[model samples]
Target: MKIRKKPPQEEFVSQAVRTGGDGQDAQEIAFIDNALFHADHAEDELFGEGSERIEVADWHFISPSCLEADGPPIKTKVLTPKQEKLLFLRYNYARRRIRQAQIRGAIRGTFESLMIWRQRAQDARDALVNANMALVPAMLRRVNCPNVELEELISEGNVALLRCVDRFDVSRGFRFSTYACRAIIKAFHRLASRRATYQKHFPAQYDPQMEKCDLGDRIHRQRWQDSIEWVRDMLTDNQAKLTLVEQTVLLERFAMAREGKGMTFEQIGPIIGLSPERTRQILRTTLRKVREAFDKDTAGPVQLAGA
Candidate 1:
């Protein structure tokens, strides 16, 4: 039997692992691109056609000219078999972390960021609706109408949604849903209060009373204002004196680092659209300012309340 010469092991392996960019080997590049594409979007339909007609912005993968009979496969890095497996695992883990971070971010932004303030705002909104509902009964009783219909109240609810949007203060840490309900109920109450029947019970308070109407109303107004004022005072009293940049950085870090975990200073900078080194510098400066502000201004004995 004629014996055919066998290529050396190193040569055979080198050919298999060939990497270069002298000319793009479209077929080889397509294979590599396909792996990464599927890893990113499992259901993605990929066309390995060269991008001569499609731009990168269109998310097309095109093989370069190198391997199209013009040159050897374009040189490029490829993971060793072990490295490829590691890359696959690491990418999946990182993607999961990103998703978890997003959920945490939504929770914090929606209700947890300003917890107490949001609660108060929501309470106020609910109170407004309750107070408005109370008005209808008061109106009916005053008019002595056992036949008062339910339609008006339902219509009033729709109006409440609008009033909530107009009056809701995001700065108050209350969701619009909470505050708008109050404004809506208040509208209903105002509408009902003008009725001649309401005068029976609320006449004195609702302005049917001739003499004490102004006094009663002013007092009520001040009391309502005071509740809001109290929240404002608390916010101001404990407020940290962070610069805009500092706040931006803090929020960025809070988003990147979640669940009691923290991001690298490098990670935060990119989030806030800054360089990683710049991010670190900002952190040092901002932390110093916050500590000093808390130190100099914190209430009795510098005790922390979720500080």
Candidate 2:
């Protein structure tokens, strides 16, 4: 019996799926069109060159501890200048190949080759990042920020390092560490400045149990109490021209002179020797007279204040 080997494209796809490619390789390949490829070439002619293939097998193994938030400082052999340059060249070259493949319009036939280049580019970038992951912890040692946690500073520094990896120019004749260190320091400074500004605006931490100022509520209650006192005085002075029966009815219905709940129309009706409907009519008339008097009394003070 003979075993038939799968084609290169099918094999590569299977390998990608096993290695957590998550369909992004296909999407990324599909995203590279002629317009973007031409735009990238026009903007930066450097991306057009550097097609030399670089071996990535040596840098493929990234330590799991390097990615852990609470893990100890990552200790990896720093890349020499030659190795650094090669990694950048490989990364950029792989990206260019994807665009070139798209331009050729043979994506289906060249899918395996495109995925290989994409994986190579990603591996090169990851190798560069892992090589310098130690810089974040080293920088944190120099920073004395009590407000920011070590984990948070590390996260910011890692982000800055990744951005530096993407933006650093090997042709500039400078070390990657030099560029990355400056970028990380700037990120830390920005984080500190933002924290300082936030603290300035909000000096204290939030506390759900903290007592809030109730000045508005107190003022509202005081105004309501003053109105009640004025109404009581008006009834005492008979200023609204209330009959004796009307006065008694108002007092009982509202519980103005008592400590208990107010009486209902039925209860007030029996007390005043009238039907419930008649008692309601009398209450309504008394309220209208009180409201008119109160409004008249407040109008002068309001107009005077405005004048």
Candidate 3:
């Protein structure tokens, strides 16, 4: 068989990773646009067609173009493999530049460069978060959480993935997927354990007293209010029947029967220009007539001992 000559690795890879007007490969731009920006619903374009769409708001990805665009708010999304590789290169390149600046004792220069490097690192980290989002759903599938929804599980996993990206060491010669899987699963267990703890410590109890006590308290307040209103209505209705002197005495002595703080005859005597004994006599006479009228108005009127 005739042997086919292999092209240079660099040239072959360069052809595969073609760039577009946005300085990103056209295929990568398409991937990011479809997977992150253009997605109308929570569909998984990352793993290609037939993948399960995690019915949720895709708030995990942000496009670099939107970094300076006067457009709608930028949401975070996962990165494609090629995009991740490029972002990784950019981050590491910035790191090396910062290191070189520091080594040369360029303190002022390093400070300015450090800011740019930090942003580059952030972009790389965000890219990693976007790319490995599928791992969150994958991790959720392995766990058993009866109470938690698949969406919640995925949410927890995404948090774990972001944290994993921050702490991940690329020098370890392992794929980010492997590291993130364990972290996401651990996060899942932590979530389940927290829920278990809550259920164990503060279990839902069918305490009849809770409802009964609240209802009883409300009822008591309502009854007390009703009693006060009824007494005021009774006092107002009978005011016309009394003489001016009697009316003044009743209002001053009983305060219209609102608070049950009826004054003694001695207290009312000076206020009404009557002697203590005379005030007592008038009060006693008024009480009998009022009690009789009150009893006539209602079937369940309170029976006074003397009246």
Best TM-score among the predictions, by candidate number: 2
Instruction: Rank the candidate models, highest TM-score first.
Output: 2, 3, 1
Tens digits of per-residue lDDT for model 3, 1-307: 9987655864443333233112343323211111232344322333336532232223443343332325344333545445554444444544444444434432334445545655655565555555566676555556778866666776788788877765555555566677778888899999988978877888885677675647787877676566445545666776326666776676667555456666777888888899988986776777676666666767433433331
lDDT by candidate, in order shown:
0.41, 0.68, 0.57
Candidate 1: 10-residue stretch with minimal lDDT: 51-60
Query: TM-score for model 3?
Result: 0.41
How well does each candidate superpose onto the true structure, as a TM-score? Answer: 0.20, 0.47, 0.41
Among the numbered candidates, top lDDT falls to 2
Instruction: Note the residue pairs that clash in candidate 2.
Output: none
RMSD to the native, candidate 2? 14.7
Stretches of candidate 2 exceeding 4 Å from the true structure: 1-75, 103-106, 211-307
Candidate 3 wrongly placed segments (more than 4 Å): 1-106, 149-152, 205-307
lDDT of 1 by residue, 198-303 (tens): 6665545534455444888797757645533432343355355666677666545543223454566777776678898888788777656555654665452332
On a 0 to 1 TM-score scale, where does candidate 1 land against the true structure? 0.20
Comparing candidate 1 with candidate 3, which one achieves the higher TM-score? 3
Stretch of 10 with least lDDT, candidate 3: 28-37
What is the per-residue lDDT of model 2 for residues 52-87, given as tens digits with 9 covering 90 to 100?
333433334335464455656655577778788767
* Span of 10 residues, lowest total lDDT, candidate 2: 298-307
